[model samples]
Target: MAHMSILLLVISSLLLASTNAHDFIKYGYNGANGADKWGSLSSDFSLCSQGKQQSPININKNTTNYDSNLKQAPRNYVLTKATLINNGINIVLKYDQGAGNLTLDGKIYALTQMIWHSPSEHTIDGQSFPVELQLIHRSSDNHIAVVAILYQYGSPDAFLLQIQDELEQLAKDKCTDEQEARVPVGVVQTRALERRTRKFFRYVGSLTAPPCTEDVAWIILGKVREMTKAQAASLKAPLSAEYQSNARPAQPINGRTVQLYDELHNVKKAPSSKSD
Candidate 1:
């Protein structure tokens, strides 16, 4: 009986650990599991509160130093098989076998996924936009680099319009809590999403969410793109109410240098601040 009891206790412990591993503790944008309480929620997330190099920072134009050597990373994206997944919190378009590769700092990172945040995350000179698109890439060594584009309400975004049907279908599907709803979006050409700008802001920062891992290279386009109100609404429609306004507030710069790369050498005119 004693041996059986010990075995049962070990099994229970293992089961508890397995459950925790599969179902990660919930973290969100507001309330109990809000950004403020993320670090304390789990040991893995301690960096969320403690990391000095966190992301989605305000890029102050006046303070940014221009680096002429900084050239825009070449985005060699092509039409590829993709899936639109509503991961309960946000809509993620994941590319299977990668859409393309970005050559940054002598390392080639494969474009794996894209995530959208409403009301923007990073701001330019303290001005916010209506939407932000983040193209996430990973290198052969598992390093992360994100290219971000901010958008204001105006002309409909071509990329978003391309996937409008998929977005609507995903939104219509009832995804159980914590379960992802995925829809195959067929071959998608991501080159249209690329902005025609030589100017961008570069910085090293952490992931904006919990488990805020640092050392991520961020390249935010200096030009603000345009998207229609309906296009923005379609993105938010899939997310739950809490995650609809799903952008983390901008983090402090913390003395980290924000570099500006402008092919035209024109830093006097700031990036556009047009809003809806």
Candidate 2:
């Protein structure tokens, strides 16, 4: 049954991405043109407004139960030549080959690109984080698995500082084009899947963006990474002023259950504002 679920998910993702690629319009997160109006923007984005299993949900610890079937996806990231794009909304990191790959339940998904969302899209127990870094993966068949790491204001994260400096440079000229950069090997993957406890929440949800395709496996790491307030400001500096909150609001979970996988059995019952 576990294998079946993964297979079906992969197939669903492939079909959705292919069918919705052309019509996958870009929508913002504000009134009229924001998330509330995504579905009406185009017939293709009907899922955004209509899907019952949308992402960026508010996760409460009490709402989840342990699932023995869930397994940790191994991270094998290699140094890669990457590019940074402002894209008006958020800063996106695009990498050439040699980034990394995730092996989940025997299925391999290649790390394609990553991006940051300010003020976080997903929250823990209705509490927001400083930022959320999303590492996007695509299987050989194009199944999408998003690994999100929540960030809080605190001691600076070395990897984040590296990217932050590059983003700050981009902000100087307000460059939105894909500028050359190098992502050190394992820098992007190390802290994401490797937490102090290595736990995560898994769910079947749609993309937070347009077309809002469903059946995309969302693997949200329980660990909350930290960066200084200055680092947070540097990240937001590249984004446009209007893109203040690039995060999407928490959507309804509908009837779906969020499964938790605690490999180390050390997840705290009470969520802390910052990660250990």
Best by TM-score: 1
C-alpha lDDT of all candidate models, in order:
0.84, 0.75
Candidate 2, residues 1-276: lDDT per residue as tens digits? 999999999986674555333223445788768888988987777898889999889888898978977766676777666777666677778776757787787998888888789999989899999899988888988788888889988888877655665666767745433432232322343343334335788888877787788888888888787889888888788666778678989999998899998855644332442223
Tens-place lDDT per residue, model 1, 15-129, is: 4333122135677889998878888888777787989999889999999999877866877888899999887777889998868888898899999999999989999989999
Q: Model 1, which residues run further than 4 Å from truth?
A: 1-23, 266-276
lDDT of 2 at 195: 40
True lDDT of residue 56, candidate 1: 85
Which residue window of length 10 is worst by lDDT in model 1? 15-24
The worst-scoring run of ten residues by lDDT in candidate 2 lies at 177-186
Local lDDT at 185 for model 1: 92
> What value does the lDDT take at residue 219 in candidate 2?
83
